[model samples]
Target: MARWQPKLGLVQETLLLTLHARALDAKLPSPILGDTLSAELAGAIDYDFGRLKVKPSLVATTALRARKLDDVVRAFVAVHPECVVLDLGCGLDPRMFRCDPPPNVGWYDIDFPEVVKLRSEHLPSRSHLIGADLTESGLLDDIPGDRPAVIIAEGLLPFMPGDSFRRMTRELAGHFPSGELALNGYTRFAAWAMKYHPTIKALGIKAAQGFDDPREPESWGAGLELVEEQFLTRAPEVALFPQPLRALTRLTARSTGLSRQGARILRYRF
Candidate 1:
């Protein structure tokens, strides 16, 4: 059988890290997200997973963050049954499968052309997969603008340039009638630290932008209001982690400052 080789750029290549993290988490005795599809997708690829040397804590953090995002999506979809869901920079991650929105909801996964092609060939999704770069103008025009929509940017924001990030947020806000934007956010310090992270450094990727305040996006001309800021280190899902990891998370959970330096999920309503 031929291995699934995806032609993705440097930034797009980072998707494999999250994919591997979810895959590793699924192998755990008590997995946080339990995404078997991610595991299968990771295995199907011919890339060298050993190069990443992904840590168990990183795996736990990835799963916990993903689970939180899934919860947010589920909650929104529960209320707005006819909403349009746009998974921006949607890589090979099977988030649509995990969320399983009602038939009334229109699900769309947007990514680079090659990545979308890879997804179509390997993953079975009911989502309308679009092949386009989010940074390009008129990208939002392809999506339904009249309906209420939920825009998810999981591991995407950090890699996007500051100007591009701001423009994208504002554009999304103006594109949809009303909805929410959910994403894993990084503080300036966290973004700097990412350069030294083993998996990140190995992939030769660096965060293009970061923010110290969760509410900072409100100034991006998006009319975005911070709905919630969920710090993963202090989340209940930490309890599901292995012994030392769980204890360490509990220790850091005591300080809001300390937890902010780690992974956080930010939700905004536009």
Candidate 2:
């Protein structure tokens, strides 16, 4: 197979990281992210992201985060059957199929125009796909505000600067009268380190901003409240990790400082 060089949009570029991580996860004796679609996508693209060297711990972290986001979307839709679910920066993730929103539930997967074009050719037509840059406001206008809403940004926050993140929050919160927002949170140091991380650097991606405290999002609006902060390493799923790695996570989970140093699935209500 010829090596396929990806000319993906920013959202698509970032989302493909999960697919790569999923591929790495498959190599594990025990795995976290088992999205067969992700594997298929990688194969279809003939992706050759040479020797990124992802640590099992990192792969486990990715899997755990994806799983939790899946759970949050599921729970949110369950309560509000008529809710509008907007997946911001949704690049080729089969979350709609996984969550299976009811017919009444409106699902919109928004990313760059080109990514949406490619996604239209590959992904099943269930939810509506919008091609727009999320950094700009007004795109949310197309989504209905009458129903309860759920906004999810899986692995996107760290890529934006603090001001931009705040603007995004304000725009999203302003769009829906009441809704749930969920994302993977990163510490300031982790955000800075991500830019220099061998894997991220090799992918030609840069870290724009990060917050040390999860509560920082609250400042975006008084309506936003911190509902939960999920520590993936301590989840029951960690027990499913491969040998040696499972034991290592156990130790990391026991230490409060060490666990917070890792990725977080942050849930908020507005």
Q: What are the per-residue Cα lDDT tens digits for candidate 2 across 1-270?
A: 333556875435766777677766755666676777766666777555565656666678887888889899889888999999988878778788878888999999988787888678877789999998777777876788788888898777877654877888888788778999998888778778887877777667775567777788888764789999888778999888876988988888898677776777889999
- What are the clashing pairs of model 2? none
lDDT of each: 0.88, 0.79
Q: How many backbone clashes does candidate 1 have?
A: 0
- lDDT for 219 in candidate 1 is 90
- Residue 179 shift from truth in candidate 2, angstroms: 1.0
TM-score of each: 0.97, 0.91
**Model 2 has how many clashing residue pairs?**
0
